[model samples]
Target chain A: MSLSDAPGPRWRPAPLLPRDEEREVSLHFVVAVLCFLACLMAVGGVSADRAARGWARDLRGEATIQVRPRLGETGDEAAARAAEAVAGVRGVTEAAALEKQKAEALLEPWLGKAVLQDLPIPHLVTVRLDRAHPATATDLKKALDRAGVDADVDDHARWLKDVERSAGVVRWAVAILFSLTAAAAAAVIAFATRAGMAARRDVVEVLHLTGAKDAFIANLFQLRFARLAAVSGVFGAGAAAAVTALIELVGGGQGFTPALPLTWMDLLTVSPCPLVAATVAALSARLTTLRLLRGTL
Target chain B: MSRQPTPRAAAAYGAEEAFDPTTGPVVRFQNVGMRYGRAPEVLKDVGFTLPVGSFHFLTGPSGAGKSSLLKLIYLANRASRGTVQLFGHDVERVARADLPYLRRRIGVVFQEYRLLDHLPAFDNVALPLRIAGRKPQTYRDDIAELLTWVGLGHKMQAMPATLSGGEKQRLAIARAVVTQPELLLADEPTGNIDPEMSLKILRLFVELNRMGTTVLIATHDQDLVGRAGMPVLHLNEGRLSRKATRRAPEPAAPDYGPELGPEYEPEPDEPELGYDLGDEEGEA
Candidate 1:
């Protein structure tokens, strides 16, 4: 007797690829860890980048001058005169003479206390420039010459350039690190896809002989891996965000020391981790599957 | 060096909508040979023609290259040398993009009964339609009815892993005919089933052939081949030798369908829909 008389509830096609493979779980863990590392790198890269910019900004707005004594004057008198000369110049926000004690304190970190008293010190003048229209070295020098002060006006141009260069290096390093992590994630996904295809040759062979296009077969793997990577991305991104939050919470007002200032906004950047992971997985799986089909199926 | 596209290929590519190719033999092989990468040829100097809608049994010993021959017909593997033509288009010369178009017209049942283990019997049978880009609702009833017709109606929701050897074989058969392809090729299709089910499966192929679907079965069952009384293309040691069939010869097939090759005869472009041929009436 025939048994198909009454059709059951509306039927839907099951997943083309098996869902409960043990390797898939392993793949998820590996991909999720990669995503977590990538997310952390992203956070660190941005924080370090911001810190570098802040240091460069500080250097750009300041200048220091070393004042030498004239035949009739003491070092202190010459330094005060130099400071007054610089303060009158255009774009000079403020200028002040540095006391010997303050200068010795600044040098204490590098030079030991034993050599400090015996050495003849040149009086110093500190200058703060208008950030929008900062005074140049030439302007400061012209003022010093006009005031008849024997001084070497250092506009901090050399230090500022070095700081800017360091910032550029940090930017590029972060960029390269980010790219390598993404590439690693993609390679891992490609490897997993290859193994998955090999394990399911029966399914692939049947689909191929049944007139499925290479794209049709590839799409199955692409979607499967993409979903796996997306969930992995979520866990990774969430962990990264939590770590960032904890550092920000315990990191005083400046965050994990003044060097890396982690703000709450950094958490928002990791939100796209899941999306990026999905994209990479989808692309890697599709390419691997098409290549396999072309070469074998 | 330059390459020239044949008139049929040009028509197939340029004016697909209006290109109704003139049909002759459904399959033609001339001095065909096949081999794996740098390996010796498994099929050598094979030559034959399968007229449209003709039924034949390809009987051979274990390493006789029966599966390899079907592989050439289905576009799974290319012929090493000489010509293998299908629907009047040369298999080797056809563009890669157009291979799927040709493959859609041919259905295969492997000796392994290569059903997707992840899918239920109903979805497994519905695979060809889904691959052809049909919606679920349109083919839902037909697929349910097809599963019922294959004695798998009650097993529609069951996975291939949960089924017995014979049940899986029947499910494979239902999937093979779901598209009602122009040509059906089987490699020991009844290898896993009982004699009764084997006869029933043979009857299924016979009925499909009568409806203008060409059939080629690769089998070791001499009794089934004898009972069917179809012409036998006997293969031994990578060579083919033909045997006369007891049944009267039918006329050559009419003109081949458009899109290169779909239905040899365009009656419904569908299967024996709800034909109630589920129970065997001793057609084999």
Candidate 2:
């Protein structure tokens, strides 16, 4: 009789592997953690590199002159003289004297605002060296001495080197963190896939005897893991993003923002984290299952 | 390429006709040997041929490799030595992609029933059809009727754990035959059922054999083998011996005791018992 003639209950076979609710939830948690760590590392690395470059660009080919108030000269008068002397130098491009208020503000972080007004703060002059005829700190100091200005020349080379080195170390640390997180994630998935295969060995044998192709059986696992990774990766990335946004929000009020501001592009770079995670999970599952099936079945 | 036999072709080729080996045996093995990893060979120098549309019983002791021999026949295990062939194709030479199709033509009823516990009886029996990519709407009625014929009509929605041993065996048998495979292999199919149910299950195999499907049953049940009166392939300590054919007795009417209720019918139509070959041809 034709099937249409019999109105029976319609049914579909349960998948060879059940949803594995507990295992999957645990896997999601792991993948999410890995994704969060990887994304945070990536953001941290990019921000550090940008900050280093900004600091270098700001300090490169520049020198600062500090003129103390003489016995009878006011601080402003000495700063004016130092600025004029530095600007007159052959290799100097421009020189600007810091006002009393600006100088006080620079010291505000170390000393209280009102108290800094009573102290004898050195008047500061910033000198930009000409690119075509760069001047050394020694040459600038000698030129200032010859101009009868009592000032000290600082090239900021030591500070710039330290900043760049620290930034490099931070970048490397971030990269190492990323690598470790990825490795840990892969290891976790591989272990879980192996456990899953062991748990479902009987099912695998039955499917094999019943004519299921290796690819079909592998896909059943690969697809599930890929989906899990993708979903968890998103959750982890989202959590990381929220945490970063909070840092930015909290740090903004205190005027302690990073040298290079975080941009939407930074977040966009981390957006593909989920896809990468899914790919890694799928490949790991596929390879593991195929190898196991070949050896055992 | 060899084409799968259509329903019309199957109808034309009666099961009672003797198989002509000259055309080639449906299954052939030469000096086949098998072992698990570094373990000793469980099956050694086993040679046999199962002709098209033939029925035979494999009899052996518990450790005599009956299941192992069946595994070799169904492509579940490869022989360490010698060659094996199924359906005119060298098993080793068959492309991996083509293995599934080859497997689709062979149905196996495992000893444990191996029903997915999460699925109901209806879904369990429909597994072969689903593996063959047949949609539910197309085979729903056929499956329901097959279950009903196996006396499992009322237990269609019951889980494997809920079904009795006889019911599970019946479900497994129904699953094996649902695809109407060209070859049906059963490993101790009647091991757990009562004598009456065993006879009934044997009749189902007989009906399937009449429809041009080769049947091989691996079991140690001598009474069942003797009652069926088919040729027997005996295995002892990895060695095989063939028993000469015996004249088959006429099938007696099954006595459905009062407990069986009206569910036990006298007989089902032969055409209904046979799979609609149209589905096979459609697959082509």
* Alpha-carbon DockQ of candidate 2: 0.23
Instruction: Identify the CAPRI category of the predicted complex in candidate 1.
Output: acceptable
Give the per-residue Cα lDDT of candidate 1 at B31: 86
lDDT of 2 by residue, B163-232 (tens): 9988999999998998888789999999889987887788888778767678899997877776565667
Scanning candidate 2 chain B in windows of ten residues, the lowest lDDT window is B275-284
- Model 2 CA deviation exceeding 4 Å by range: A1-13, A60-94, A98-124, A128-165, A253-273, B1-22, B37-40, B93-98, B134-137, B248-284
- Per-model i-RMS: 2.5, 4.2
- Tens-digit per-residue lDDT, A1-297, candidate 1: 455543455656778888756898898888989899999989998998888888877887899999988998988899899999999899999999999999998887788888888887668999999989999989999999999987887877788788778878887888888889899999999998998898888788878888788999999999999999999999999999999999999996678988898899999979999999999999999999998887853
Q: Please write out the lDDT profile of model 1 over residues B159-241, one tens digit for every residue.
A: 89999999999988898898888889998899989977787787788788877788899999876675566667777777775
The whole-model lDDT of each prediction reads 0.80, 0.76
TM-score of each: 0.86, 0.75
